[model samples]
Target: MTTTLFSAFWTYTLITALTPGPNNILALSTVTSHGLRQSSRVLAGMSLGFLIIMLLCAGIAFSLATLDPALIHILSWAGAAYILWLALRIATSPPTDAAVQSRPVSFWASFGLQFVNVKIMLYGITALSTFVLPHTRELVWVVGISVLLAAIGSLGNLCWALAGHLFQRLFRRYGRELNIILALLLVYCAVRIFY
Candidate 1:
Protein backbone atom coordinates (compact mmCIF):
# COMPACT_ATOMS: atom_id res chain seq x y z
CA MET A 1 0.00 0.00 0.00
CA THR A 2 1.07 3.52 -0.65
CA THR A 3 1.84 5.86 2.24
CA THR A 4 -1.51 7.60 1.75
CA LEU A 5 -3.40 4.31 1.76
CA PHE A 6 -1.56 3.14 4.84
CA SER A 7 -2.46 6.29 6.70
CA ALA A 8 -6.09 5.97 5.66
CA PHE A 9 -6.22 2.32 6.71
CA TRP A 10 -4.88 3.07 10.17
CA THR A 11 -7.37 5.89 10.59
CA TYR A 12 -10.23 3.62 9.58
CA THR A 13 -8.96 0.97 11.95
CA LEU A 14 -8.74 3.34 14.92
CA ILE A 15 -12.20 4.68 14.31
CA THR A 16 -13.75 1.25 14.04
CA ALA A 17 -11.92 -0.04 17.07
CA LEU A 18 -13.11 2.86 19.23
CA THR A 19 -16.68 2.99 17.98
CA PRO A 20 -19.72 2.00 20.07
CA GLY A 21 -20.37 -1.52 18.87
CA PRO A 22 -21.69 -4.49 20.80
CA ASN A 23 -18.35 -5.13 22.47
CA ASN A 24 -18.00 -1.56 23.68
CA ILE A 25 -21.61 -1.37 24.77
CA LEU A 26 -21.27 -4.61 26.69
CA ALA A 27 -18.03 -3.52 28.31
CA LEU A 28 -19.56 -0.19 29.20
CA SER A 29 -22.66 -1.80 30.66
CA THR A 30 -20.74 -4.50 32.50
CA VAL A 31 -18.38 -2.11 34.23
CA THR A 32 -21.18 0.29 34.98
CA SER A 33 -23.12 -2.43 36.78
CA HIS A 34 -20.66 -5.13 37.76
CA GLY A 35 -17.36 -3.23 38.14
CA LEU A 36 -14.04 -3.27 36.30
CA ARG A 37 -12.92 -6.62 37.61
CA GLN A 38 -15.85 -8.30 35.92
CA SER A 39 -15.52 -6.24 32.76
CA SER A 40 -11.81 -6.91 32.53
CA ARG A 41 -12.46 -10.62 32.15
CA VAL A 42 -14.97 -9.86 29.46
CA LEU A 43 -12.45 -7.61 27.78
CA ALA A 44 -9.86 -10.35 27.85
CA GLY A 45 -12.31 -12.78 26.38
CA MET A 46 -13.15 -10.23 23.68
CA SER A 47 -9.49 -9.76 22.84
CA LEU A 48 -8.97 -13.47 22.50
CA GLY A 49 -11.98 -13.62 20.27
CA PHE A 50 -10.62 -10.84 18.09
CA LEU A 51 -7.33 -12.68 17.75
CA ILE A 52 -9.17 -15.76 16.61
CA ILE A 53 -11.04 -13.75 14.03
CA MET A 54 -7.89 -12.11 12.76
CA LEU A 55 -6.25 -15.48 12.26
CA LEU A 56 -9.32 -16.77 10.54
CA CYS A 57 -9.26 -13.75 8.25
CA ALA A 58 -5.64 -14.39 7.51
CA GLY A 59 -6.35 -17.96 6.51
CA ILE A 60 -9.31 -16.99 4.37
CA ALA A 61 -7.40 -14.21 2.69
CA PHE A 62 -4.34 -16.29 1.95
CA SER A 63 -6.21 -19.37 0.78
CA LEU A 64 -9.04 -17.90 -1.24
CA ALA A 65 -6.86 -15.28 -2.95
CA THR A 66 -10.06 -13.24 -3.17
CA LEU A 67 -13.15 -13.00 -1.01
CA ASP A 68 -16.41 -13.74 -2.69
CA PRO A 69 -18.83 -10.84 -2.65
CA ALA A 70 -21.72 -13.15 -1.89
CA LEU A 71 -19.96 -14.63 1.12
CA ILE A 72 -19.58 -11.21 2.68
CA HIS A 73 -23.31 -10.63 2.47
CA ILE A 74 -24.05 -14.03 3.91
CA LEU A 75 -21.70 -13.53 6.80
CA SER A 76 -23.16 -10.11 7.42
CA TRP A 77 -26.68 -11.51 7.68
CA ALA A 78 -25.61 -14.31 9.98
CA GLY A 79 -23.75 -11.88 12.17
CA ALA A 80 -26.72 -9.53 12.27
CA ALA A 81 -28.97 -12.32 13.49
CA TYR A 82 -26.56 -13.21 16.24
CA ILE A 83 -26.20 -9.56 17.25
CA LEU A 84 -29.97 -9.18 17.35
CA TRP A 85 -30.10 -12.05 19.81
CA LEU A 86 -27.53 -10.28 21.97
CA ALA A 87 -29.58 -7.10 21.71
CA LEU A 88 -32.58 -8.95 23.12
CA ARG A 89 -30.48 -9.98 26.06
CA ILE A 90 -29.31 -6.41 26.58
CA ALA A 91 -32.85 -5.07 26.29
CA THR A 92 -34.14 -7.33 29.03
CA SER A 93 -31.27 -6.65 31.42
CA PRO A 94 -32.37 -5.23 34.77
CA PRO A 95 -30.89 -2.15 36.36
CA THR A 96 -27.52 -2.53 38.09
CA ASP A 97 -28.93 -2.37 41.61
CA ALA A 98 -31.73 -4.83 40.85
CA ALA A 99 -29.85 -7.33 38.72
CA VAL A 100 -29.15 -9.91 41.35
CA GLN A 101 -30.70 -12.72 39.33
CA SER A 102 -28.82 -12.02 36.12
CA ARG A 103 -25.51 -13.73 35.76
CA PRO A 104 -22.42 -11.80 34.74
CA VAL A 105 -21.19 -12.52 31.22
CA SER A 106 -18.70 -15.32 31.44
CA PHE A 107 -15.34 -15.33 29.66
CA TRP A 108 -16.20 -18.39 27.59
CA ALA A 109 -19.44 -16.80 26.46
CA SER A 110 -17.66 -13.62 25.36
CA PHE A 111 -14.96 -15.60 23.58
CA GLY A 112 -17.50 -17.69 21.75
CA LEU A 113 -19.56 -14.65 20.85
CA GLN A 114 -16.61 -13.25 18.90
CA PHE A 115 -16.79 -16.12 16.43
CA VAL A 116 -20.18 -14.96 15.27
CA ASN A 117 -19.70 -11.25 15.86
CA VAL A 118 -19.95 -9.71 12.43
CA LYS A 119 -18.49 -6.39 13.46
CA ILE A 120 -15.11 -7.67 14.53
CA MET A 121 -14.91 -10.40 11.92
CA LEU A 122 -15.87 -8.03 9.16
CA TYR A 123 -13.38 -5.55 10.45
CA GLY A 124 -10.65 -8.13 10.29
CA ILE A 125 -11.62 -9.22 6.81
CA THR A 126 -11.72 -5.64 5.63
CA ALA A 127 -8.29 -4.98 7.02
CA LEU A 128 -6.92 -8.13 5.51
CA SER A 129 -8.30 -7.53 2.07
CA THR A 130 -7.83 -3.79 1.93
CA PHE A 131 -4.48 -3.42 3.62
CA VAL A 132 -2.53 -6.59 4.19
CA LEU A 133 -3.23 -8.73 1.15
CA PRO A 134 -2.97 -5.92 -1.36
CA HIS A 135 0.21 -4.54 0.03
CA THR A 136 2.57 -7.44 0.57
CA ARG A 137 0.73 -10.74 0.99
CA GLU A 138 3.75 -11.62 3.10
CA LEU A 139 3.09 -13.93 6.00
CA VAL A 140 4.98 -11.55 8.25
CA TRP A 141 2.79 -8.63 7.26
CA VAL A 142 -0.38 -10.60 7.90
CA VAL A 143 0.79 -11.76 11.30
CA GLY A 144 2.06 -8.32 12.25
CA ILE A 145 -1.21 -6.65 11.33
CA SER A 146 -3.17 -9.28 13.22
CA VAL A 147 -1.12 -8.64 16.34
CA LEU A 148 -1.55 -4.90 15.96
CA LEU A 149 -5.31 -5.41 15.55
CA ALA A 150 -5.43 -7.51 18.70
CA ALA A 151 -3.59 -4.85 20.68
CA ILE A 152 -5.80 -2.10 19.31
CA GLY A 153 -8.89 -4.15 20.17
CA SER A 154 -7.63 -4.75 23.68
CA LEU A 155 -6.95 -1.09 24.30
CA GLY A 156 -10.30 -0.09 22.86
CA ASN A 157 -12.20 -2.49 25.12
CA LEU A 158 -10.22 -1.30 28.11
CA CYS A 159 -11.13 2.27 27.36
CA TRP A 160 -14.77 1.34 27.08
CA ALA A 161 -14.61 -0.49 30.39
CA LEU A 162 -12.96 2.50 32.04
CA ALA A 163 -15.60 4.81 30.61
CA GLY A 164 -18.25 2.59 32.07
CA HIS A 165 -16.54 2.63 35.44
CA LEU A 166 -16.51 6.42 35.43
CA PHE A 167 -20.05 6.64 34.13
CA GLN A 168 -21.23 4.45 36.97
CA ARG A 169 -20.90 7.43 39.26
CA LEU A 170 -22.24 9.98 36.83
CA PHE A 171 -25.30 7.98 35.75
CA ARG A 172 -26.24 6.61 39.12
CA ARG A 173 -29.54 8.36 38.88
CA TYR A 174 -30.29 7.37 35.29
CA GLY A 175 -29.26 3.75 35.17
CA ARG A 176 -32.33 2.52 33.40
CA GLU A 177 -31.97 5.03 30.63
CA LEU A 178 -28.37 4.03 30.14
CA ASN A 179 -29.26 0.37 29.79
CA ILE A 180 -32.09 1.19 27.41
CA ILE A 181 -29.89 3.36 25.26
CA LEU A 182 -27.15 0.76 25.14
CA ALA A 183 -29.65 -1.93 24.15
CA LEU A 184 -31.07 0.28 21.44
CA LEU A 185 -27.61 1.02 20.09
CA LEU A 186 -26.77 -2.66 19.99
CA VAL A 187 -29.87 -3.20 17.90
CA TYR A 188 -28.81 -0.34 15.66
CA CYS A 189 -25.37 -1.83 15.21
CA ALA A 190 -26.88 -5.17 14.30
CA VAL A 191 -29.14 -3.58 11.71
CA ARG A 192 -26.26 -1.65 10.27
CA ILE A 193 -24.30 -4.83 9.59
CA PHE A 194 -26.83 -5.84 6.98
CA TYR A 195 -26.95 -2.49 5.25
Candidate 2:
Protein backbone atom coordinates (compact mmCIF):
# COMPACT_ATOMS: atom_id res chain seq x y z
CA MET A 1 0.00 0.00 0.00
CA THR A 2 1.06 3.58 -0.66
CA THR A 3 1.92 5.84 2.31
CA THR A 4 -1.38 7.70 2.01
CA LEU A 5 -3.38 4.46 1.93
CA PHE A 6 -1.46 3.11 4.90
CA SER A 7 -2.16 6.26 6.87
CA ALA A 8 -5.84 6.17 5.91
CA PHE A 9 -6.14 2.50 6.92
CA TRP A 10 -4.67 3.09 10.37
CA THR A 11 -6.86 6.14 10.85
CA TYR A 12 -9.97 4.19 9.97
CA THR A 13 -8.95 1.25 12.15
CA LEU A 14 -8.30 3.43 15.18
CA ILE A 15 -11.51 5.38 14.79
CA THR A 16 -13.61 2.24 14.43
CA ALA A 17 -11.90 0.49 17.33
CA LEU A 18 -12.32 3.46 19.65
CA THR A 19 -15.93 4.02 18.71
CA PRO A 20 -18.81 2.81 20.89
CA GLY A 21 -19.60 -0.54 19.37
CA PRO A 22 -21.04 -3.61 21.10
CA ASN A 23 -17.73 -4.83 22.50
CA ASN A 24 -16.65 -1.48 23.93
CA ILE A 25 -20.12 -0.68 25.24
CA LEU A 26 -20.41 -4.05 26.92
CA ALA A 27 -16.97 -3.67 28.46
CA LEU A 28 -17.98 -0.30 29.91
CA SER A 29 -21.27 -1.65 31.21
CA THR A 30 -19.67 -4.72 32.74
CA VAL A 31 -17.07 -2.66 34.58
CA THR A 32 -19.67 -0.18 35.78
CA SER A 33 -21.97 -2.87 37.17
CA HIS A 34 -19.32 -5.21 38.39
CA GLY A 35 -15.83 -4.03 39.41
CA LEU A 36 -12.71 -4.10 37.27
CA ARG A 37 -11.57 -7.42 38.74
CA GLN A 38 -14.81 -9.18 37.84
CA SER A 39 -15.14 -7.45 34.51
CA SER A 40 -11.65 -8.45 33.37
CA ARG A 41 -12.89 -11.90 32.44
CA VAL A 42 -15.47 -10.45 30.08
CA LEU A 43 -12.92 -8.15 28.52
CA ALA A 44 -10.46 -10.98 28.04
CA GLY A 45 -13.12 -13.12 26.47
CA MET A 46 -14.07 -10.32 24.12
CA SER A 47 -10.46 -9.90 23.07
CA LEU A 48 -10.03 -13.59 22.43
CA GLY A 49 -13.25 -13.71 20.48
CA PHE A 50 -12.16 -10.72 18.43
CA LEU A 51 -8.85 -12.36 17.61
CA ILE A 52 -10.63 -15.47 16.40
CA ILE A 53 -12.97 -13.38 14.31
CA MET A 54 -10.11 -11.50 12.74
CA LEU A 55 -8.35 -14.74 11.91
CA LEU A 56 -11.53 -16.01 10.34
CA CYS A 57 -11.85 -12.80 8.40
CA ALA A 58 -8.33 -13.23 7.07
CA GLY A 59 -9.22 -16.62 5.62
CA ILE A 60 -12.67 -15.57 4.46
CA ALA A 61 -11.51 -12.42 2.75
CA PHE A 62 -10.65 -14.26 -0.43
CA SER A 63 -13.85 -16.30 -0.49
CA LEU A 64 -15.92 -13.23 0.20
CA ALA A 65 -14.98 -11.85 -3.17
CA THR A 66 -17.21 -14.44 -4.80
CA LEU A 67 -19.68 -14.87 -1.96
CA ASP A 68 -23.35 -14.17 -2.49
CA PRO A 69 -24.71 -10.86 -1.26
CA ALA A 70 -27.77 -12.57 0.22
CA LEU A 71 -25.68 -14.38 2.81
CA ILE A 72 -24.32 -11.13 4.12
CA HIS A 73 -27.84 -9.72 4.38
CA ILE A 74 -29.01 -12.72 6.37
CA LEU A 75 -26.13 -12.40 8.76
CA SER A 76 -26.85 -8.71 9.19
CA TRP A 77 -30.48 -9.40 10.10
CA ALA A 78 -29.45 -11.96 12.70
CA GLY A 79 -26.85 -9.63 14.17
CA ALA A 80 -29.31 -6.73 14.40
CA ALA A 81 -31.91 -8.89 16.12
CA TYR A 82 -29.36 -10.11 18.67
CA ILE A 83 -28.19 -6.57 19.34
CA LEU A 84 -31.78 -5.42 19.87
CA TRP A 85 -32.31 -8.18 22.40
CA LEU A 86 -29.15 -7.11 24.23
CA ALA A 87 -30.45 -3.53 24.26
CA LEU A 88 -33.73 -4.65 25.83
CA ARG A 89 -31.85 -6.55 28.50
CA ILE A 90 -29.66 -3.56 29.25
CA ALA A 91 -32.63 -1.19 29.35
CA THR A 92 -34.45 -3.35 31.89
CA SER A 93 -31.46 -4.10 34.14
CA PRO A 94 -31.60 -2.79 37.67
CA PRO A 95 -29.18 -0.29 39.17
CA THR A 96 -25.73 -1.28 40.37
CA ASP A 97 -26.18 -1.47 44.10
CA ALA A 98 -24.54 -3.82 46.58
CA ALA A 99 -27.95 -5.09 47.62
CA VAL A 100 -28.77 -6.05 44.06
CA GLN A 101 -27.75 -9.67 43.32
CA SER A 102 -27.24 -9.52 39.59
CA ARG A 103 -24.97 -12.10 38.05
CA PRO A 104 -21.81 -10.74 36.50
CA VAL A 105 -21.43 -11.26 32.78
CA SER A 106 -19.57 -14.51 32.20
CA PHE A 107 -16.57 -14.96 29.94
CA TRP A 108 -18.56 -17.35 27.78
CA ALA A 109 -21.40 -14.88 27.43
CA SER A 110 -19.10 -12.15 26.21
CA PHE A 111 -17.27 -14.60 24.00
CA GLY A 112 -20.51 -15.64 22.39
CA LEU A 113 -21.46 -12.01 21.84
CA GLN A 114 -18.65 -11.48 19.33
CA PHE A 115 -20.20 -14.00 16.97
CA VAL A 116 -23.23 -11.79 16.63
CA ASN A 117 -21.44 -8.46 16.67
CA VAL A 118 -21.81 -7.07 13.17
CA LYS A 119 -19.61 -4.05 13.64
CA ILE A 120 -16.42 -5.92 14.38
CA MET A 121 -17.13 -8.49 11.72
CA LEU A 122 -17.40 -5.73 9.18
CA TYR A 123 -14.45 -3.98 10.72
CA GLY A 124 -12.22 -7.02 10.25
CA ILE A 125 -13.49 -7.80 6.79
CA THR A 126 -13.24 -4.25 5.55
CA ALA A 127 -9.74 -3.79 6.92
CA LEU A 128 -8.59 -7.01 5.33
CA SER A 129 -10.17 -6.40 1.93
CA THR A 130 -9.74 -2.66 1.44
CA PHE A 131 -6.30 -2.30 2.96
CA VAL A 132 -4.40 -5.57 3.24
CA LEU A 133 -5.56 -7.70 0.32
CA PRO A 134 -4.79 -5.07 -2.32
CA HIS A 135 -1.17 -4.95 -1.20
CA THR A 136 -0.54 -8.64 -0.70
CA ARG A 137 -2.20 -12.01 -1.16
CA GLU A 138 0.13 -13.95 1.15
CA LEU A 139 -1.58 -15.77 4.00
CA VAL A 140 1.05 -14.78 6.57
CA TRP A 141 0.74 -11.07 5.84
CA VAL A 142 -3.06 -11.19 5.90
CA VAL A 143 -3.21 -13.04 9.22
CA GLY A 144 -0.62 -10.74 10.75
CA ILE A 145 -2.51 -7.63 9.76
CA SER A 146 -5.75 -9.10 11.09
CA VAL A 147 -4.04 -9.93 14.40
CA LEU A 148 -2.71 -6.38 14.67
CA LEU A 149 -6.15 -4.97 14.03
CA ALA A 150 -7.58 -7.25 16.68
CA ALA A 151 -4.99 -6.01 19.17
CA ILE A 152 -5.93 -2.42 18.44
CA GLY A 153 -9.58 -3.28 18.99
CA SER A 154 -8.74 -5.07 22.22
CA LEU A 155 -6.86 -2.02 23.45
CA GLY A 156 -9.88 0.08 22.67
CA ASN A 157 -12.03 -2.23 24.79
CA LEU A 158 -9.59 -1.85 27.66
CA CYS A 159 -9.81 1.92 27.38
CA TRP A 160 -13.57 1.74 27.73
CA ALA A 161 -13.27 -0.61 30.68
CA LEU A 162 -10.89 1.77 32.39
CA ALA A 163 -13.22 4.69 31.74
CA GLY A 164 -16.04 2.78 33.41
CA HIS A 165 -13.80 1.97 36.37
CA LEU A 166 -12.69 5.57 36.76
CA PHE A 167 -16.25 6.87 36.62
CA GLN A 168 -17.85 4.06 38.62
CA ARG A 169 -19.13 6.35 41.34
CA LEU A 170 -20.83 8.68 38.89
CA PHE A 171 -22.18 5.77 36.93
CA ARG A 172 -23.58 4.17 40.05
CA ARG A 173 -25.40 7.36 40.95
CA TYR A 174 -27.11 7.56 37.55
CA GLY A 175 -26.97 3.91 36.64
CA ARG A 176 -30.50 3.68 35.33
CA GLU A 177 -30.24 6.74 33.11
CA LEU A 178 -26.88 5.70 31.76
CA ASN A 179 -28.14 2.20 31.03
CA ILE A 180 -31.11 3.62 29.18
CA ILE A 181 -28.81 5.76 27.12
CA LEU A 182 -26.53 2.84 26.39
CA ALA A 183 -29.53 0.79 25.37
CA LEU A 184 -30.64 3.57 23.06
CA LEU A 185 -27.20 3.67 21.52
CA LEU A 186 -27.36 -0.08 21.00
CA VAL A 187 -30.75 0.31 19.40
CA TYR A 188 -29.25 2.87 17.06
CA CYS A 189 -26.46 0.43 16.21
CA ALA A 190 -28.99 -2.25 15.40
CA VAL A 191 -30.96 0.14 13.21
CA ARG A 192 -27.84 1.22 11.41
CA ILE A 193 -27.17 -2.35 10.32
CA PHE A 194 -30.18 -2.23 8.06
CA TYR A 195 -29.24 1.00 6.37
Candidate 3:
Protein backbone atom coordinates (compact mmCIF):
# COMPACT_ATOMS: atom_id res chain seq x y z
CA MET A 1 0.00 0.00 0.00
CA THR A 2 1.07 3.55 -0.68
CA THR A 3 1.87 5.75 2.29
CA THR A 4 -1.38 7.62 1.77
CA LEU A 5 -3.49 4.49 1.79
CA PHE A 6 -1.62 3.10 4.77
CA SER A 7 -2.29 6.25 6.74
CA ALA A 8 -5.92 6.24 5.75
CA PHE A 9 -6.35 2.59 6.66
CA TRP A 10 -4.97 3.03 10.14
CA THR A 11 -7.01 6.13 10.70
CA TYR A 12 -10.20 4.35 9.71
CA THR A 13 -9.34 1.35 11.83
CA LEU A 14 -8.64 3.44 14.92
CA ILE A 15 -11.76 5.51 14.52
CA THR A 16 -13.99 2.50 14.03
CA ALA A 17 -12.47 0.58 16.90
CA LEU A 18 -12.44 3.46 19.37
CA THR A 19 -15.94 4.60 18.71
CA PRO A 20 -18.83 3.21 20.72
CA GLY A 21 -20.32 0.05 19.25
CA PRO A 22 -22.05 -3.00 20.59
CA ASN A 23 -18.87 -4.72 21.75
CA ASN A 24 -17.36 -1.67 23.40
CA ILE A 25 -20.64 -0.63 24.91
CA LEU A 26 -21.25 -4.07 26.32
CA ALA A 27 -17.74 -4.30 27.68
CA LEU A 28 -18.09 -1.02 29.50
CA SER A 29 -21.44 -1.98 30.94
CA THR A 30 -20.26 -5.42 31.97
CA VAL A 31 -17.28 -4.06 33.83
CA THR A 32 -19.29 -1.31 35.47
CA SER A 33 -21.85 -3.83 36.68
CA HIS A 34 -19.69 -6.87 37.39
CA GLY A 35 -16.18 -5.46 37.91
CA LEU A 36 -13.04 -6.16 35.85
CA ARG A 37 -12.27 -9.57 37.32
CA GLN A 38 -15.73 -10.88 36.57
CA SER A 39 -15.82 -9.23 33.16
CA SER A 40 -12.76 -11.12 31.90
CA ARG A 41 -14.76 -13.96 30.44
CA VAL A 42 -16.95 -11.56 28.52
CA LEU A 43 -13.94 -9.70 27.15
CA ALA A 44 -12.26 -12.94 26.18
CA GLY A 45 -15.37 -14.08 24.42
CA MET A 46 -15.60 -10.83 22.45
CA SER A 47 -11.97 -10.99 21.45
CA LEU A 48 -12.19 -14.60 20.31
CA GLY A 49 -15.38 -13.97 18.44
CA PHE A 50 -13.97 -10.80 16.85
CA LEU A 51 -10.88 -12.69 15.73
CA ILE A 52 -13.06 -15.30 14.09
CA ILE A 53 -15.02 -12.62 12.33
CA MET A 54 -11.84 -11.02 11.03
CA LEU A 55 -10.72 -14.38 9.62
CA LEU A 56 -14.08 -14.79 7.91
CA CYS A 57 -13.73 -11.32 6.48
CA ALA A 58 -10.49 -12.37 4.82
CA GLY A 59 -12.39 -15.09 2.96
CA ILE A 60 -15.35 -12.86 2.33
CA ALA A 61 -13.14 -10.16 0.81
CA PHE A 62 -12.76 -12.33 -2.26
CA SER A 63 -16.28 -13.74 -2.48
CA LEU A 64 -17.93 -10.40 -1.95
CA ALA A 65 -17.47 -9.80 -5.65
CA THR A 66 -20.89 -11.40 -6.09
CA LEU A 67 -22.52 -10.36 -2.83
CA ASP A 68 -26.20 -9.54 -3.07
CA PRO A 69 -27.49 -6.18 -1.96
CA ALA A 70 -30.62 -7.85 -0.62
CA LEU A 71 -28.54 -9.95 1.73
CA ILE A 72 -26.86 -6.81 3.04
CA HIS A 73 -30.25 -5.25 3.70
CA ILE A 74 -31.43 -8.35 5.51
CA LEU A 75 -28.34 -8.37 7.68
CA SER A 76 -28.75 -4.69 8.53
CA TRP A 77 -32.31 -5.24 9.68
CA ALA A 78 -31.43 -8.24 11.78
CA GLY A 79 -28.50 -6.46 13.35
CA ALA A 80 -30.55 -3.44 14.22
CA ALA A 81 -33.22 -5.57 15.85
CA TYR A 82 -30.69 -7.44 17.93
CA ILE A 83 -28.98 -4.23 19.05
CA LEU A 84 -32.34 -2.78 20.04
CA TRP A 85 -33.03 -5.81 22.19
CA LEU A 86 -29.67 -5.39 23.86
CA ALA A 87 -30.39 -1.75 24.47
CA LEU A 88 -33.59 -2.68 26.20
CA ARG A 89 -31.75 -5.18 28.34
CA ILE A 90 -29.13 -2.62 29.31
CA ALA A 91 -31.72 -0.04 30.16
CA THR A 92 -33.70 -2.35 32.38
CA SER A 93 -30.96 -4.34 34.10
CA PRO A 94 -30.17 -3.17 37.61
CA PRO A 95 -26.57 -3.00 38.72
CA THR A 96 -25.35 -6.10 40.54
CA ASP A 97 -22.92 -6.56 43.39
CA ALA A 98 -19.70 -8.26 42.41
CA ALA A 99 -19.72 -10.39 45.55
CA VAL A 100 -23.32 -11.45 45.06
CA GLN A 101 -24.42 -14.19 42.70
CA SER A 102 -25.27 -12.56 39.40
CA ARG A 103 -25.18 -13.84 35.88
CA PRO A 104 -23.02 -11.70 33.66
CA VAL A 105 -22.93 -12.19 29.89
CA SER A 106 -21.31 -15.54 29.29
CA PHE A 107 -18.53 -16.47 26.92
CA TRP A 108 -20.83 -18.37 24.60
CA ALA A 109 -23.39 -15.60 24.44
CA SER A 110 -20.78 -12.95 23.58
CA PHE A 111 -19.14 -15.29 21.07
CA GLY A 112 -22.45 -15.76 19.30
CA LEU A 113 -23.05 -12.01 19.30
CA GLN A 114 -20.22 -11.44 16.82
CA PHE A 115 -22.09 -13.34 14.12
CA VAL A 116 -24.84 -10.73 14.16
CA ASN A 117 -22.76 -7.70 15.09
CA VAL A 118 -23.22 -5.61 11.97
CA LYS A 119 -20.83 -2.89 13.08
CA ILE A 120 -18.02 -5.40 13.39
CA MET A 121 -19.05 -7.15 10.18
CA LEU A 122 -18.89 -3.89 8.29
CA TYR A 123 -15.66 -2.88 9.99
CA GLY A 124 -13.80 -6.06 9.04
CA ILE A 125 -15.27 -6.27 5.56
CA THR A 126 -14.44 -2.70 4.72
CA ALA A 127 -10.96 -2.85 6.19
CA LEU A 128 -10.02 -5.96 4.25
CA SER A 129 -11.85 -5.36 1.00
CA THR A 130 -10.87 -1.73 0.68
CA PHE A 131 -7.48 -1.45 2.34
CA VAL A 132 -5.88 -4.87 2.76
CA LEU A 133 -7.14 -6.76 -0.29
CA PRO A 134 -6.53 -3.93 -2.70
CA HIS A 135 -2.93 -3.75 -1.56
CA THR A 136 -2.08 -7.46 -1.46
CA ARG A 137 -3.69 -10.84 -2.13
CA GLU A 138 -1.10 -13.06 -0.45
CA LEU A 139 -2.60 -15.45 2.06
CA VAL A 140 -0.05 -14.62 4.74
CA TRP A 141 -0.60 -10.90 4.37
CA VAL A 142 -4.36 -11.24 4.52
CA VAL A 143 -4.26 -13.37 7.64
CA GLY A 144 -1.74 -11.10 9.28
CA ILE A 145 -3.79 -8.03 8.63
CA SER A 146 -6.88 -9.80 9.95
CA VAL A 147 -5.11 -10.69 13.18
CA LEU A 148 -3.81 -7.17 13.55
CA LEU A 149 -7.25 -5.76 12.99
CA ALA A 150 -8.69 -8.10 15.59
CA ALA A 151 -6.05 -7.00 18.08
CA ILE A 152 -6.78 -3.34 17.46
CA GLY A 153 -10.49 -3.93 17.86
CA SER A 154 -9.92 -5.88 21.04
CA LEU A 155 -7.79 -3.06 22.33
CA GLY A 156 -10.66 -0.71 21.70
CA ASN A 157 -12.98 -2.88 23.79
CA LEU A 158 -10.41 -3.01 26.54
CA CYS A 159 -10.16 0.75 26.59
CA TRP A 160 -13.85 1.03 27.30
CA ALA A 161 -13.74 -1.80 29.78
CA LEU A 162 -10.94 -0.11 31.64
CA ALA A 163 -12.85 3.11 31.74
CA GLY A 164 -15.77 1.32 33.31
CA HIS A 165 -13.53 -0.49 35.74
CA LEU A 166 -11.84 2.74 36.71
CA PHE A 167 -15.12 4.41 37.50
CA GLN A 168 -16.99 1.46 38.91
CA ARG A 169 -17.71 3.17 42.19
CA LEU A 170 -19.15 6.35 40.68
CA PHE A 171 -21.13 4.32 38.14
CA ARG A 172 -22.56 2.13 40.86
CA ARG A 173 -23.80 5.18 42.73
CA TYR A 174 -25.66 6.33 39.61
CA GLY A 175 -26.23 3.02 37.94
CA ARG A 176 -29.68 3.73 36.63
CA GLU A 177 -28.64 6.95 34.93
CA LEU A 178 -25.59 5.30 33.45
CA ASN A 179 -27.66 2.46 32.10
CA ILE A 180 -30.05 4.85 30.44
CA ILE A 181 -27.23 6.74 28.79
CA LEU A 182 -25.60 3.55 27.59
CA ALA A 183 -28.89 2.34 26.20
CA LEU A 184 -29.36 5.58 24.30
CA LEU A 185 -25.90 5.32 22.88
CA LEU A 186 -26.63 1.77 21.76
CA VAL A 187 -29.83 2.95 20.15
CA TYR A 188 -27.81 5.50 18.22
CA CYS A 189 -25.48 2.79 17.05
CA ALA A 190 -28.40 0.70 15.81
CA VAL A 191 -29.93 3.60 13.97
CA ARG A 192 -26.65 4.35 12.26
CA ILE A 193 -26.87 0.95 10.53
CA PHE A 194 -29.60 2.15 8.20
CA TYR A 195 -27.48 4.89 6.78
In candidate 3, what residue range of length 10 has the lowest lDDT sum? Answer: 95-104
Compared with the true structure, what per-residue lDDT tens digits does model 1 show for residues 1-195?
A: 789998988898889889988888888877887788666678788889888888888888777876788877887787778777777777777775765345678888788778878888778878878888877878888988987887787778888889988878764467778878888898899888867
Evaluated against the true structure, the overall lDDT of model 3 is 0.89
Best by lDDT: 3
| TM-score of model 2 vs. true structure | 0.95
Name the 10 consecutive residues with the lowest summed lDDT in model 2: 95-104
Quick one: RMSD of model 2?
1.4
**In angstroms, what RMSD does candidate 3 have relative to the true structure?**
1.5
Residue range with the least summed lDDT across 10 consecutive positions in model 1: 95-104
lDDT of 2 at 27: 86
**Candidate 3: tens digits of C-alpha lDDT, residues 1-195:** 899999999999999999999999999999999889989999999999999999998888865654578877898888898888889989988865632257788998788878888899889889888897777888899999999999999999999999999998999888889999999999999999997
Any residue pairs clashing in model 3, and if so which? none
Question: What shift in Å separates residue 180 of candidate 2 from its native position after superposition?
Answer: 0.2
Ranking by TM-score: 2, 3, 1
